[model samples]
Target: MLNKTRGRPRGNPDTKARIAEAARELFLERGYKGTTVRAVAAEAGVDSALISYHFGSKQRLFGQSLNLLCVESTALDQALQGDQAGLADRLLTSVTSLWDATAPTENRMALQDDDTMRAFRDYLESELLVRVAEFLGGPDATERATAAVGVIGGLIFTRSLNPIRSIAALPSAEVRRIFGPALRAALHARARQH
Candidate 1:
């Protein structure tokens, strides 16, 4: 025999998504540090334990919310999988392809908003910076990583803004060919001491 006690239900089928949506909204509203698991759970109308059960931790939840645009991006992961050699070309190509595929349907307008952009930039700096620094693996890894992120961010910004018609018209291959070496230079530049 089993005994079950419930008022409404133990869990909602949409609980995970609700939690994610709440976290995303809170993160956009308050930034990472300002948002807490308890707050997210409250916003989602679930228990804090559910958040931990779903996402493990606040950092992981933030990462998942931040990645809503990119999703899994297996291509990007594959590009970063192995040798550092030709990493710039692989990374640039992967990222450009991903953006090109999603640009038309995705809400590019969200990026135009100041608050959204700031939140995204903060997420990128916190998440990508460390990953890139580790991937570069050298005495000046941090500096090179920062430069690489800047170069990539600049490229994305210009493409998004589309200030130049010709530049915008260029195919992904051409764009990759042109920017890959520049990215390489940014990532591989001689370490400068500060």
Candidate 2:
């Protein structure tokens, strides 16, 4: 004879998402070095084993957490697929348009602080710049991609932070006209071979 024990369900359907969300918040607060799986599990209100079970390891968890901020933009993907010429403009335009459309959600109050924003920026570099490097696919692709991403990040930060009224208030077209050349230079700049 076996006794059947009935109680609340032992598992949560949303645990994976909850863990990812907790990991993101912790990464933003503590950064990659400071965050731990145990801490993330505590934050997520689950056992540490669940973090290991779901994410496998801290590095994987960090990667997954960074992915949370990524909103797929077909336009951006298309922009990256064409000729290298005008890529900067296309990339910038696609990014700006997407940002404009999703500004409310992307610029949520929780990400308003400097530390959180810095963390977010670092995550963006890891996620977006790495892909940009892979897309360029050449000897100096990584170097060029870093510079290009830096240009894009600077433009975004300035525009969103509204530090300079002229740059911030300029229409998107005007922005594309002015900053496009700089991004192009970054994307195509050559590194001297050692």
Candidate 3:
């Protein structure tokens, strides 16, 4: 006769997946600041310790849930390299294509709440805009980078989510052609010392 040990059951590979799925759903529903590890654990039917064990932290869990493991940084880095003249075109191509290919669910998460939007903006600034500004390297670099990112972001939001008729009707190549010059101008804005 063996005595029964009472404790939480051992976690299987499936538990991680379940936790991730739960995290994604909660993140989409409640946004980043609103969602907690305890909530995710509840949603996943697991203990909070399991979340810590599996993902280490809420931020890590969020990253896994969103599948955004340095995607923006990598994309921006690639777009920023080689041929400064074509920077706008390359950025438009890379960034638009990326968002266009992204799942609707993930995109919806960005639109969920103020917290989510702030988180998204913060992530974008840290990952892409700030990097672009650093790459440009000038007194006007930050503003120029912001303008460039705004143009790209507006295009993505309009084309992908909101769908403005004029912008939506244009083919990808035409969109790139029409917007490239403005973006290039913004990026090439002259540096000034005040």
Ranking by lDDT: 3, 1, 2
- lDDT of every predicted structure (CA atoms): 0.71, 0.71, 0.72
Winning model by TM-score:
1
Tell me how far the alpha carbon of residue 33 in candidate 1 is from the true structure, in angstroms, after superposition: 6.1
Model 1 residue runs over 4 Å out of place are 1-13, 32-42, 45-76, 105-107, 161-163
| Better-scoring candidate (TM-score), 1 or 2 | 1
Measured with C-alpha atoms, the lDDT of residue 80 in candidate 3 is 84
Per-residue lDDT tens digits for candidate 1, residues 1-194, read 54332122265677778888999899899876578888998898777877878777776687466553432335556677878877898778766776676662252554666766777677557656667788889899898888988977776666653335566567889988888888889888987656
Q: Taking the tens digit of each residue's C-alpha lDDT, what string does model 3 give over 1-194?
A: 64222224464568888989998888767766677888998898888888877777775677677664323544566788987678898898876666556664466545555544555555556546877888788678899999888887777667655668898778678888999988999898776656
Question: Residue 133 deviation, candidate 1, in Å?
Answer: 0.6
Give candidate 2 regions above 4 Å deviation.
1-20, 29-76, 103-111
Residue-wise C-alpha lDDT for candidate 2, range 17-107, written one tens digit per residue: 8989999889888875677888998898877877777777665677466552223435546678888887888897876675566553344
Clashing residue pairs, backbone N/CA/C < 3 A, model 3: none
Give, for candidate 3, the lowest lDDT window spanning 10 residues. Answer: 2-11
lDDT of 3: 0.72
Query: Which wins on lDDT, candidate 2 or candidate 3?
Result: 3
* Total backbone collisions, model 1: 0
